[model samples]
Target: MTYRILLVDDEAMTKRSLYKILTGANASYRIVGEASDGAEALQIARREQPHLIITDISMPVMDGIELIQRLREDGLDMDIIILSGYGEFEYAQEALRHGVVDYILKPMKQEQVTLLVEKRFDHFMKSRQTAIIKSQLIAPISSAAERIGHELWIANEPGMRKEMRSLSGLLDDTEFMQEERISLLRDAASLISNRLQPQFPHQAWELPYEGQSYGQASESFAAWLDKLLNEIRDKRNWGKRGVIQQAIDYIKTNFADSELNLEKVLAPLGISSTHFYHMLMEETGMSYIAYLTQIRMDHAKELLEHSDLKTYEVGQRCGYPDYPHFTKRFKRQVGLSPSEYRKNMQQA
Candidate 1:
């Protein structure tokens, strides 16, 4: 992957030289922006949202340590490297405390800097890939358990009941490899039992069969199973109130796209417009439009606080067709307009 870098140094010549050397050494890397001082570096870092920052220890306005502290406070995740001419132990200690990835002395070789950056980039990619695989495995295991729970509700046979009881006992075992799967099954069973509490006040096996025949018992079990599965599936569906969270994840991945909307969102879920709206409200406790507005506003706040994106560009990136609407919603949610929020954040 091509990594974006930001170079910050008080000397224009030093910054230009370092940028040229780094870019020439690695075609896979790009110097996205350069800053003359620490203050300007922070602005460029936010606006460009570079993957990495290389900065000098001493600079006018804001120093490297202060910039790192401020970036951490704002929750920016860019990696930082500090450069200094003198070997000051105190400055190195401070940079380490602020979680800088590397500290290099001035008059350093170009090869040494490039090697350190490449190592960090490789580590970041490996960790992210591992997390994605783990999440994928958990989802299918949870879904399969939910299906088994639904099947048990419909069967309600003596043998199946015995199996469920056995399964519930094994759920707490530390030795089980499929712990998430078993926990999901236990949750589904508990939910079904809760739903039938009014009718079958006692345990499932203890329910009285006063006027009911065997066929009625079977029918009742089938109906209950259908209702339970529907409830689970509805809550799990991405288009309903759950869509609020889905919308957040979607926006995070596609925030750069300027035309994201409710229609495009509904297309993937394959639900009717009316049902989609109601489900979104039920799951998220807000209308579809309201939820979408909240997401856009929240994203605007992040950009205003962390990135140097102009207010209009931030609004456009967040899917606000009108800049005025974006400003209005941002003010309503954050208690300040976008520009005002940015000013307050910078001041703090």
Candidate 2:
């Protein structure tokens, strides 16, 4: 990722020199804006919110100390580097107290500028890595626990197991040490326990999972979750059948409506199109349209054999709005046109 830097100084020459040094030293460090004074720097900071700000201590307008204080007050946590001359040590010390990362002495050499920026970049990268690792471990555990709650509420055992597998898979994928992995799993188990505790007060479980390997802890947690879900399923009455089942029922009842479609049918079920499609395939061994067509064709055959309704009326009753298309679909599925099938059924 490109790190943005804002340069602030009263002297145009100093700002230009700093820009040249940064551009030559690091391609990833981009100079987003320059300000002649700290007041202008604050204005640009509000707009740009640059990753780093390099500012001179003394200027006509609000100086670096004031800028840092204001930015802190505004809750903007930007890394700052103060520029100080030989006699400005006291100002540099003040900048440090105000959370400046480092101060650069004036009459700065290219090497000095390059080294300071490089060190700041290194610090930035390390901080980012730490945040990433922390988030990676924390977020997935919360997500997995939340998923467990949702699946349990829906009385979906398979979905619950799927979430458990995902939780385990997350631990497997991380590059954490054995101890760290164990700790992460323990944390996850604790979180999951908290979520399920209110529901399963008697079955409050604890994991002395410290000495256990990552795989063992994961397996233990998965088994415990499976048991908890089973207990929940046995106790509570859930909502109308799972989303896919509700969708299937909707299709069956509305099959004769020519406008009945995947989108319209599944919209009320609140399942995504892809998920609805896959569930139809998995549960019924056919795509949604294919299953709907099978139902329509079967019902059409019943109308043809038993009812006195004409073949066109049978087609219309079975959700085929267009006569030719209805005839085409009937022939394709039943190996004969509707009229021919009716005659054969009558002869039989």
Candidate 3:
């Protein structure tokens, strides 16, 4: 789906330059409208309901801050990015307080724009997917599966119960069939089973209806899912092993991120680089670099065989933005260059 963007700046040049920069960065970003002032921007925003709004903080009539406040009052949940000149740091700070996602200084750099836009959009997609998971069964379930895995990884029994209780209405509502719901849940669980220890066994996440049916307010269904999550959490084992598993899971989920690295992975887990490396090697019998390389290479091979993405694009998605480096690594790991691999697979 094309993500719509709205540009708000009094200067025509500013809007023009930003539009050029944005559309150049990604083809999927469609600039829906441009407004000169904050009030005009607000009107376009309401009419369009854009996914992202890039607005200057110092527009006349209705300043960006006031516009943002008005948007909140009107219950608009648009993601915002503020544009500010050198002295407008205070306005940017206030914007951040109001949940502006990020700010860009005047004269946007190409590298910075590409990085920030992709990062924010990636997060926006993830949040959108989570909202879908909460509302209904998303088709294929792979998009929402990682979220379920993460939730199950962290949640204990009581917390899982409370979280699943929010979905009790979905469980009880006749709007969705039980088999459809269970099928979605099972597909998500199948994706989640990858994070399990080598011996958690099969059918662990299945809902048991031996004694109860959906007639009982779906309380049983909710409780069963909660229990299943907690059991998975226990198997994940929030110890040093859990840290390693979390790192592995992060690697698997974010293999596409070209900037992901050991420091980034361990930053949230509160573990040092040396410690994590050693622990990962000792516990899993696989070095951190080896595992990351294997994961990326596996994904690279899959993309080469299954999709028609360009070799460089395939490399980028597998965390190797440098084409030469990616080619070198692919040849070393898979015994063929990416293009060669694709050619062979397609021919076969």
Q: Which stretches of candidate 3 lie over 4 Å from their true place?
A: 135-348
**Candidate with better TM-score, 1 vs 2:** 2
Per-residue error at 272 for model 1, in Å?
38
Determine which window of 10 residues in candidate 1 has minimal summed lDDT: 199-208
Score every model by TM-score: 0.44, 0.48, 0.42
lDDT comparison, 1 vs 3, better candidate: 3
True-structure RMSD, every candidate: 20.9, 16.2, 21.7
lDDT of 2 by residue, 186-207 (tens): 6776776676565455354455
The candidate 2 region of ten consecutive residues with least summed lDDT is 232-241
- Mind giving the per-residue lDDT tens digits that candidate 1 earns over 1-348? 678889998888888878877888778688999997878888888899988899998888998889999889889988898887776668878898989998878787787787887887786676566455444334323322333453333232342344344334333332323434333443544554654444234343221344554334334444544555455445445334454446445644675455767677766666687886765554444565666665566567657766988999898888776889878878886677888877865543
Ranking by lDDT: 2, 3, 1
Best by lDDT: 2
Whole-model Cα lDDT of every candidate shown, in order? 0.64, 0.78, 0.72
Q: For residues 146-189, could you state the per-residue lDDT of candidate 3 as single tens digits?
A: 33343454443443444354344334442444554555455555
* Residue pairs in collision within model 1: 46-307, 46-308, 47-308, 240-279, 240-280, 241-279, 241-280, 241-283, 241-284
Task: Flag the better candidate by lDDT, 1 or 2.
Answer: 2
